[model samples]
Each structure stands twice: as structure tokens, then as C-alpha cells.
Target: MRPLSTATLLCMSLIVPSLSQAEPRPANMVYLRTVDPTIEQDIRYATAHNFTGHPLDGYEAPQCLLSLDAAQALARVQASLKAQGYGLKVFDCYRPARAVADMGRFATQPGDPRKAEFYPRVDKQDFWHLGYVAKVSNHSRGNTVDLTLIGPQGLPADTWSPAASQADCAAPYGQRWHDGAVDMGTGFDCFDERAHTDSQAITATAQQNRERLTEALKKEGFVGYSKEWWHFTYAGDGAQKAVMDFPITAP
Candidate 1:
């Protein structure tokens, strides 16, 4: 065979991905409902209810898919909360790597309809620098989750209004959209320092609710992100696993 020219080799390399460069497909992921039906789920990225104001890529259904280990840990957290007239309501879990890329793409675009509710204070271009959006998220590993607590009525006591006054993510509860989730200082995916897990700027009631959630997840081996009260990562082998690109299809 004749030796291929360097230019030809480079072109071929660009056209075909090497097997070594391909990410590994993970096994044993499960929908959260399979392990614990009591846990409530919003799965925001799968619906138009998220920061993007549109369904994200790779989320085919509104489902809380997660690594088995992470799901089980979440189940334990649910059990603990249930006894106290509270239940877990997850916003996101087991995000696909493609979805992370989608988030980055959306941030670059102009005209976000939901910006007032999710990121009113921070500009979209600053998302990466502010850690509001990431190129690589722990969620792709199927071990991270964004969640909150639901009250005994199984309803969010949100005081939602499109005309609600706009405030920074750190603004106290009623100032933002009445996101049905329990008042955790800010709305889900609220991109602000006020959303910081340990922020002392929130009301005493909101602070208590935030601590309650953190303590519940902590007992199950999950660690809350300092910047987002709703974000948690399972600290185990799952966190070290390869990021996934599987869609959240219905079982």
C-alpha cells in the first residue's frame, strides 16, 4: 500500500473519531421512580420550566434518571424527610453531557424570556465565569442532583407571578417567581451569591429550610455545592465514573 500524505491523514483524523477518544457508555442507570416512588420530581430540563425556557437536548422525557448508587442514596434521604412531613422534590438528575453543551450554547444566545426569573442580575455571558454554567458538570456522571423539599400538602407554596419584582438570586423568597418548590432563599438554578448554600442573607425561615435539606442529604453521603443550595453530588465511585450522554427516555 502507498503511504498516505500527512494532509490526507489529518483530514481523516478530523472526519473519524478514534475509538480511544470515544466516551464509554455507562450501565445500570435507573429512573428515580423505580427505586422510590415517594420522591417528587420536576425534571425541569426535560420541560419548558427551566432556565432555558425550553426543553434541553438529551432530555426526551421528564424523568429523574440517576446512577443506581445515587438514586439509592436519594431514596434514603427521602425516607428521612418523609417522617418529618416533608418529601424530596428533584429538579434535575443524571444530566447528559450533550445537555451540558446545550446549556453553554443557550447562554451564548440573546433574548432569554425567563432571564428575569432565573438570572435577572447576572448576564448570560458571565455564566461560565460566575460558575452558573459549566462545560463539564458532575450531573453527567449520573451522581449529581438538583432538588428541594416539598411540604406536607405535597404542593409548593410559591407565590408565583410573572410580574413579580425582579431581585438578585440572593433576594428573599417572595421576591422571585413562586417556584413551587419550598422557599430555599431563591428559585431553582438561581444564579447568584444569594443562592449560595450557606448564604446568611436569606430569612430565618428560608435558612432553616435550606439547612434541613442539607442535613438530610448529608446523612446519605451526598455533598451540597456551596454556590447552589439545590445542587448535590454523590461522593463515591459514581462521581469518578465517565460522563454519560444517554437521553432521559421513559422506561
Candidate 2:
């Protein structure tokens, strides 16, 4: 083969660096909406409607990205629930590693503007010890998700604003902030024992709702976290193990 000319070699150098600098999303990861548009998504971290009172790092868009395997499994769960006049709604999925670090920083910080509605009874510093937040989250691996069940009887979710009234997360279903989801003992991200998956402190109706959601997800190889009723991690084949830090972006 002939030796490359000077201009050809220069052009090759520029192309090589550009390609090397690119950090395209892995082929195995995908947005959940593409997998199942019917499933509802209310990605809280993408907005300031979460425990942190601010959007975490790497969440540029409110989209549910997950491992293809986990997304497929969740879609199956959504399908099964639809037959029973129910649907799945996700709060978070595929959290970036930087977001996890942001959570850690939030726990140590002084501000807790949203504490009344998210973690009313727990101290922000105790979030890690109480198992409400993790230093290394499985969500970064793209197989875990925080979700809730929506049914015909659920009250309409009120639009949250900075001026909205703050209600304790553990308050009775009707008295608390209505997230348009069935009562599961406590609201999402409630750092209290009432949010425990098998806690008996809740009403029978709430217990039944938790069980229904748990069983539906379990059938698809997703395992629930005992501490947080809304948290589940997919443990089936093709589940990702390495943590990912890709920024959540608008498609």
C-alpha cells in the first residue's frame, strides 16, 4: 500500500480524536418509552419535585432510560397490569452515578426545603443509614427503578409547585399529597418505616396494593427492596453490573 500523503494523515488525526472523544450511549441501553409508550413516567429527579429539592446532576431530561433487558421486563409487567385495569408509573430509572453523588451531598447539606413531603420524620443525615438513599445505587447499572401503581380509583395527581401545601408523606392516603397513584402506605421517597414493603402499620387496602405491585414485578424477575416499597431491581439475564454515568438527555 502507498504511504498516506501529509494532508490525508492530518485529516485522519482529527477524525480519530473526534471519534475517541465521543461517548455515545451503549447499544444495550434504551429509553423506556421506546420500549413501551403506554407505561407512564414521572421522572422526579429530572425536575425539582423530589427529596433533594433540586434536579440532580446528569439529569438533563425527564426520561426513563434503562437496560434493554430491564425495560423489556417492565413492559411485560405493564402489559399484565393493563388487563386488570391498572398501569405502571415510574418515578425514576437509570440514575447516573453523578446523581448518586449529588444525593450523598444533599444528605449532608443544611437545606431540606422539600423535607415535609418527602422525609418528614427522618433527618436528612440519616438517609443513608435508614436505607432510603444509597451511596452506590443499583439504578446506575440501569436495571433498577422506582415506581408505583395507578388504578381507576386513584385520585387525580395535583400539579406540584413551590407554593403547594406540604403534607407529611406518612399521612393517610386521602390527606397526603396525591401522586395519582394508589396508596402504598406512604408516598414515594418517604424515609420512614411506613414505606417498608411488608410494614403492617398501613391500612389493609394499602397492604393489598403493595402486594399486587410486588407480585406483578416479581413475576418478571424484579426483586423489591424491603426498605422501600417503590424500589425494585431487575435480576434477570442481561442485567447490567457496571455503573453508568451517561447524562439523561432529550431524544
Candidate 3:
């Protein structure tokens, strides 16, 4: 809620100037740590939603867009979780605007069979109209994050099963163990109505799983998105800024 302190601001100024253009982080550094009730809240909500994915450990900067303030905010949220027996597990962070811009590289439509190997559900059809994702993500602002909650062990139950590969959020949890690394009822970025944060169409067990995540996230401040139950952004009182094109890369 409060703006970056004078001390943090000075530190950020020093760090930002020293970084340089480089390749994507080793699929690891993409996740950064930060504190925001929103992120915790998001994780709790995910547990309820039935997220089974693991938290990512780093982030990617937009090709050209950067937000040091947002990065600090994220670190704050991570710190808060460490205080409560939880650690922030990230998925994707600081998406480079260039990556977003390069969306065209894929099928102009998300459903183009050419890319079906990449996106299994829905199709190239929803990218623009359906809002599966966009050319300009607020994540480029460094103010958004993609993550899920871990258990007391700092790890979640193995949501994957032999059947996990075919499981959908709406499937019966009793009939099958949770699938995917996230605690949410479905997989991350799963494009389906059942993936909605709260969908009656899902089995009772799946619904309960989602509720678990929601309750936890609410305690923190991260609110869930109605469309994609697994997606939540730590949008505090910060101003909405321009999108960046910095790609996620590591040293």
C-alpha cells in the first residue's frame, strides 16, 4: 500500500543501471521474490481452485520495459510468506513486451493447427477476442505475477497421476487424484469454462480444492480472476504503467 521507501528507492536506482541485455534466464531466474498480500491470497485461492503446478523461481523482463518499484513490491510479498511458513512459488514473471509482441510468431490465431502442439485446448481463436493472453500484458509492468501455493512442507501434494495428462478442472477429483503442479482444480493457462475460478460444472471435490486456495489467498489480499482461476496479479495501489518489451533472460 505504501510507496517504495527512500532507502529501497536508492538501492533500486543502483541495481537497475548495472544490468545489461542478455539471454533468457536459465529457465530458473525468471522467478523473483517479493511481498504482497495479493500473491499469498492468490496462492491460497489456487489451493482451493485445485492448482497443482509448482511455483517458478524467477522472472523475465520485458525487452525494454522495466519496473523496479514493481519488483520490490514482489520481494516484499515473498518476505511476508517466509514469515508464515510459506514461500512464494512463481510460474512466469516480468514477461518481456517483445515476447508479447512476438505473439504473431505463433499462429495469428491460438487455434492454428500448426501450433496445436503448443496450445492443446481452445485454439488460436481466443488470443485476441477471448482474452487468453494479449500482446501487451500488465506483467510487462513488472507488477503482475503467475504463481500458486505450497503446503506446510513447502511442497504441495503430488497433483499429478498417470491420468493427470488427461485430467481437466471439471473432472471428478474423487475419481482421480489432482493433476498438474498447481493446486488449482485445473492446469495453468487451461482454456476452459471449467477452469473458471469457481464453476459449478466442476465436481464437488474439485470445487473444495479451489475453495482451499481462495480462502488462503483472501487472507493475503490477492484476488482471483473469474476467467482463469490460476491467474492472479499483485495489483496494489500502484499506478498502471506502460507495457515493456524486455524478454526474460538470466546471467
Candidate 4:
């Protein structure tokens, strides 16, 4: 319930310098680390470890960029969770429009090199149809984030183990993607019904973890995506901002 610090407020101001303008100014986007360096970030698109099996465009570096307001809100969420012996670990934030476009393109022309790991039951061409990929993502608006909770040990409960079998997202522990995130039924961007926020198929423990993440984020006005437990959006003015195409790089 604490208010954003003056420093965070000042940083937020820099994220959207032209609120009066009709179109959003991409340059106004600020790196999340600048607002709160203590938060952990693992921007997946900057590397080849994601579902794409390769680095997407417009992700020049591993960075978490967000609108000022969103960053400020997330910082608050992080503080609240930290007090509860949990913390936030971001996967993606403020995606560039070009990267979203790249995802769409990948959907059309792809073999499934990573299918066994990411979307084994789904076809590549069906990604758009299944709502696994969005033509226009909320992330491009700079207010959405894909994240998970770090436990009291300062890391996710599960860790990626290359030796683990590749199983459906809803599969039991050691059978699903080992992304080291707190067990939330499925891995981040699992593209499965099990990833749904309220899915009852997962174990009670996963459900509790998901709810814990939801409550922490909700405390700061971040809304969880019903389809993706790890995804959340700050429904602030930044939600209405124009989508951006800037690369995510260190500021």
C-alpha cells in the first residue's frame, strides 16, 4: 500500500513525455532496470532459448523496457512480494512491434524444431488461430509483462534441466519444460490450456503458486491474462499508448 517513491515517480515521468500527443513516442520508453535495478529480468526474446528457437528481431539485448507508469507499478509489486519472501522475475516486457510481427511471420513459415519443447500438441500454423500468438500484442504498448515469482531462496522452484523429458505443459514436475520458475502448472508461454490462470487440471501446489503471483501483481493494479498465468498488464494510460517497434537494449 506504499506509494511510489519520488525517484520512481520521476523515472515514470520520463517514460511518456508526450501524453498529450495523439501517437505514443517510442523514445519515451525507459528500461525497467533504470527505475528499479533490484528486480530480476530474463528477457527471452533476446536469445535463442525461446519458443522461436532463434532470436527474434528488434531484441538487440536482454532488457526489460516498460512505460514509466508500468515500471513504477511493477516496482511496487516487487517491493510488496519481497516483503512476503517472494520476488518478481520478468521474462519479457515492452515487446517491440517488429518482434511481434516476427512471431507472426514465424507462425506462417516454420518447421517444429522446438515443437517438442514449446508446443508439441499444436501446429505451427495454428498458433494465430489458437490465440497463442497475437498480431498486436499488449506488450508492444509497454504495459504488459511476462513474469514469475522467485521464492525465499531467491530463485524459481524449478530449474531448467536439459536431461528432463519434454512433456505437455500440464505434465507433472520433471516432465514439463524446466524453466526454473515457480511451478505454475506450465512454463512461461507454454501455449496450452493448462497455462490458463484458473485451470483445475494442475496440482494444488501449482494453483497456489499461480494465485500467489496473481495476488502480488494485483496489489499493484496489474491484471493477469486469463490464458497465460505469467502474463500481466498494467491498465494505466500506457495501455492506450501506441504500439512501439524499438529494440530492447540497455539504456
- List, residue by residue over 143-219, the lDDT tens digit for candidate 1: 89999878743234444333443444455555555556667777788887888988888778788888899999999
Give the clash count for model 3.
71
Candidate 4 residue lDDT tens string, 1-251: 99999999989878866536424346557888999998888787887667787788988889998888889899998888878887888999988888999999889884665676677777888888777899999999889999988774333345444334355656675566556566778877787788889999888988888888898888777898887889999986555467777666666
Off by over 4 Å in 1: 1-25, 153-172, 237-240
Preferred candidate (TM-score higher): 1 or 3: 1
CA shift of 236, model 2, Å = 0.4
Candidate 2: lDDT of 180? 93
Candidate 3 RMSD to the correct structure: 12.7
Q: Give the whole-model CA lDDT for all candidates, comma-separated.
A: 0.81, 0.92, 0.48, 0.79
Scored against the true structure, residue 69 in model 3 reaches a CA lDDT of: 46
Task: Give the residue spans of candidate 3 off by over 4 A.
Answer: 1-88, 109-121, 152-183, 215-221
Judged by whole-model lDDT over C-alpha atoms, candidate 2 comes out at 0.92
Each candidate's root-mean-square deviation in Å?
5.3, 6.2, 12.7, 11.9
Clashing pairs in 2: none
Q: All candidates' TM-scores?
A: 0.83, 0.91, 0.56, 0.83
Pairs with backbone N, CA or C atoms under 3 Å apart (clashes), candidate 4: 158-180
